[model samples]
Target: MAQNKQKRGPMQFLQFGVIGFANAAIDIGTLNLLLLLFHTDAKGLLLLYNTIAYTLAVANSYYWNVIITFKRSAEGSNRQRILFIVQGLVSLGVNNLIFLGVNELLQLIGINNWLQYNVAKGMAMFLSFLASFFMVKYVVFRDYGKRYIDEKN
Candidate 1:
């Protein structure tokens, strides 16, 4: 079982990466579209667009991750769903905060707005990917019984 679990971990990670890439593309693409459509130079509007896009991406991620990446770990319990949502919200907050901070810093350093936005989004996505993997693996979908039991006990 331990070996099987170990094998599954890498497969899960790959699936998670694929799903995350799709979701992040959706989010960044939506934000860019909104920016292009608005023709506005307001930071607040960008933030607002990001918030909306992130929410949509989170929802998409939850479904895909549950069905694809963590299918074996998924429980058909309301508690599991709630836990997943909480984990996602935490990731969302971390990603958004990092994005805003990095973007602002780049702006202050006189980086071009286009490059700043792309770089900030890329960094935030990478960080959030790491954060979400750990949270989902150790918190939301943890196998408590397996962890507490020992082979020689």
Candidate 2:
């Protein structure tokens, strides 16, 4: 069992990476689509669009990470679901802060365009991705005694 866990560690990370890529695509794609459709580059709208995009990606992440990456049995208990949501919201806050910060810095430097927005988004996605992976693995889906949650002895 220990040997299996040792081997599965790296494999699980790889699977998580694959899922992360898909999540990134969904996130960035949705944000860009919103930008294009609305034809507005307003800062406030960017936040709104980013939130929508991130939320969609997070939903996808929860689905795939449970089934393929973390390999949890099913949808899991209410506590697990609540933890996921809390983690996701924290990650989203991290993502948005980085995104807005980077974009603002770029604008201050006179670099304003799609490239700037994407650059900020990319940085946000990467940092939040790392945070999300750790939280999901160690906190959300971690095994506890006979189940994913601890029971009273």
Candidate 3:
């Protein structure tokens, strides 16, 4: 990873925030649908459900961040796309860390597992969203080439 961050305006941050909110909704919606379809909340099932929902949310994030938030032209290359995935992976790690940690802590304190898991998820999502905005805005989506990319200056 390259770390050449370009200066961005407040409006761009707002656009990114809007997209994040949409994706967060998608994530929660997917999780709920999965739970309904399976009619169970086993540990393995919860993990699988969350994984699927997170992936969909990540895909949605990529699309909207590139199309609406970043507003890049058709200059994105394979290299940049790979970096985008890398950034997402890092974000996922950050999210999972907070989620598992919080959940475990709640369990230790005798919190109801169901409520504990949800609260953990919400907290993790908040922290990961913050991390992802910085990574996408400064690293993954930053212009890295010249004639190959007419990046927003």
Candidate 2 regions exceeding 4 Å error are 73-75, 146-153
RMSD value for candidate 2: 3.3
Best by TM-score: 2
**Root mean square deviation (Cα) for candidate 1:** 2.5
What digit string (tens of lDDT, one per residue) describes model 1 on residues 1-153? 678668888988899999989998988887778777775557777678778777888889888988888776677578778888898888888888888999989989999877888788888878988998989988888766645564334
Q: Model 1 — which ten-residue stretch has the worst lDDT? A: 144-153
Pairs in steric clash, model 1? none
Give candidates' CA RMSD values in order. 2.5, 3.3, 4.7
Better of 2 and 3 by TM-score: 2
Native-vs-model 1 lDDT?
0.82
Clash list (residue pairs), candidate 3: none
Please give, for residues 89-111, the per-residue lDDT of candidate 2 as tens digits: 99999999999999999988888
- Alpha carbon lDDT of residue 112, candidate 1? 82
If ranked by lDDT, best first, what sequence of candidates would result?
A: 2, 1, 3
Give each model's whole-structure lDDT.
0.82, 0.88, 0.75
TM-score of each: 0.88, 0.90, 0.79
Candidate 3: C-alpha RMSD to true structure equals 4.7
Error of 2 at 142 (Å): 0.9
